[model samples]
Target: MSIEPAGHGIEADNALDRRFSGRNEAVPDEAHHDGRGRFYWFLIGMRGIFSLPALILMTSYLGFAAFALDVGLTRSEAVFIWALPAQMILVGTMAGGAHLAASFAAVTFSSIRMMPMVASVVPDMRNDKTPTIVLLALSHFIAITSWVFATQRLRHVPRPYRTSYFAGFAITLTSINTAIVGIGYGVVSAFPPVVAGALFMLTPVYFISSIWASARQPVVKIAFLFGIVLGPLFAVIEPQFDILYAGIGGGTVAYAIDRVRRRRHAAGGV
Candidate 1:
């Protein structure tokens, strides 16, 4: 319910002790803060390898764009129409410079959201400048998959090992992404238009799967359901505003339901 500034140095505190004990605690050694074993780290690293398929799927976008280009669409023309308008708006806001500025802004936003995960791992690092920097740098690789695995699967490991295991997982996944991007770029260039078009489905499939897998809360579930139904309806009226309408509308409905449920439960004294 409240937010606090993330600490700079690891300190001996009761709060830190409690952080390792909660039921939903992400790390195993919440108390000791020691990292996991090398073998365990290796297994975690395997998760990184799984990133290849996901990254390959992502690269399908580039392929689809190329296909669009080959079919007589200009690069800017295709991007302006097919890509999210927010992207175009961002570029337009950049004072008539290259659209890469908008791309950088989007990345910066993602990085800002990523800071909390990095903060969660910071306490477990070895209390030295070099190790801290190394861990922080490696933390960039921590994505939803690694975070979910770390929080759900690795919580039983000792605290000392959790950070190391996560680091291994992150490092491997990063390598997988790097490799897939390079491969996908080359593959899309060499493949036929139909094949490239087929590959573009990978992005939507990946996103659908991820959303289905990660929709844990009742609010999220309801919002997703409503979004699916209402999205197209709103798109018919105003395409660019569909997501905003569905998200805000569904979220409002979900919040009201949750509020009423809480009130009823309180009245029932359950």
Candidate 2:
């Protein structure tokens, strides 16, 4: 019912404990106030609609929508493509006259990045008591930003409220993205080409910056670096299959490097 400053939840919880617990009484956990906890976190998630993560997602979808419009896709088609769990590369293929099978393949391949995210995040938020349908449904919301945000913040969130918090965050993010995609498509032609170019460029720039800001693991950093270096080169060599080849080669190289580094460290010298 009330808004607190960011990062104040722990302090507030401590204060609540001091106020509520007597000398002989044990402090109640967050789940003891499950309804309030979920409501509070849900509100927090909804309030974060204007934050950087949402902005990045909105800009990226905007760029995609604009491109789809330019390539003669109808508004409904554009929304349909955006709604699909595919990356922008699949949409690019569609725009470039690729067949249905090729588009599906590219989309599936592009989505492999989501696998690690799913494997890492779901277990943290779930328990044996959690329902199968809940896990299955929430998996759809496990994109890059949501995964990063949830991985960090859910540690502080109560077990019972994590799913509710995430649902609110994901819903707010996707709703804004869906709306912006339509807006971008409608406005792309209304603006000049120079402006349109800048708008479209926002997507890739935001994506790279988001990754650069969030990546901490050595293997991930190395993989991203190799991908950046190899992507253009592979594009030049064979444009059609560039994403697939670059991802495979870059990931392999990074994994090899990481294994070598770990082995050396284990031997007590690196």
Candidate 3:
């Protein structure tokens, strides 16, 4: 006779149940769901004021200034000659055909990674399509830092709110990025090379730090470590193909390891 969890309607033999049982415990109270909601809203509100200014100043001073140096222009010359024109083009092109094309490409590429996340959360959403599409659209706003933070710090949030929380996070980040790009053009000339370099380091450093902090699963750790070690080696061989090779190579390795582990566990149980 088949057995099931009493009153829960879930079968005892459900693979999903087994997976959840094997997963880590929920996040603690200091990182509670309600507190995270408050923080998320706070970040959204801050985006219009403090975040925008900081982003603009940093991007202009760091990214634009660094680009200037790379092209052998003095800071002033770079700002006036290169940065200004570039900013103008970016802003102007936002409503142009190229911008639309780039946006479509970005959306298409982003959807590939996003679909898995949506699928994972679909049950939690009770198969609600409206919220799913809305959240998917909102996901375009997400960058590495917010994703890491949301995944690590907001474990208590019900599945439905996770998308909304991510939406808020992405919106805040997008505003900050836009503001930074705008401000960076004007102020890049005033910053010294060292200061500019520091600014340029922000995005990369944040991404690395977030990944290190958020990666919990053995499979993820293996994939990431392998990707890191193999990425440069492959890049040296063919820079354009490095990412493709690393993803396929690392994914295959991880899948093989998982398969072996599962087989051993099944054998042991038998």
Error of 1 at 82 (Å): 21
TM-score against truth, every candidate = 0.50, 0.69, 0.55
- Expressed as tens digits, the lDDT of each residue in 200-219 for candidate 2 is 57656655655554454578
- Clash-forming residue pairs, model 1: 20-30, 29-158, 29-159, 33-160, 34-160, 34-161, 35-160, 35-161, 36-161, 48-173
Please say which candidate is ahead in TM-score: 1 or 3.
Answer: 3
Candidate achieving higher TM-score, 2 or 3: 2
Best by lDDT: 2
lDDT string for model 3 (1-270, tens) is 111121122322343454364343334322454756646645543442343223433454346544545445444454343223234334334434466666555445434544444443444332242455675675544333444444443333434344554555456555554455445544556667687677667666654544554454456667667778888998998775676677678767976887788789899999
User: What is the per-residue lDDT of model 1 for residues 127-245, given as tens digits with 9 covering 90 to 100?
Assistant: 33235566766665555444444433343344455556666766565555444444444235676767766676665555444454444345655655776778788889877556567
Cα-lDDT of candidate 2: 0.69
* lDDT for residue 263 in candidate 3, whole number 0-100: 88
Which clashing pairs does model 2 show?
A: none
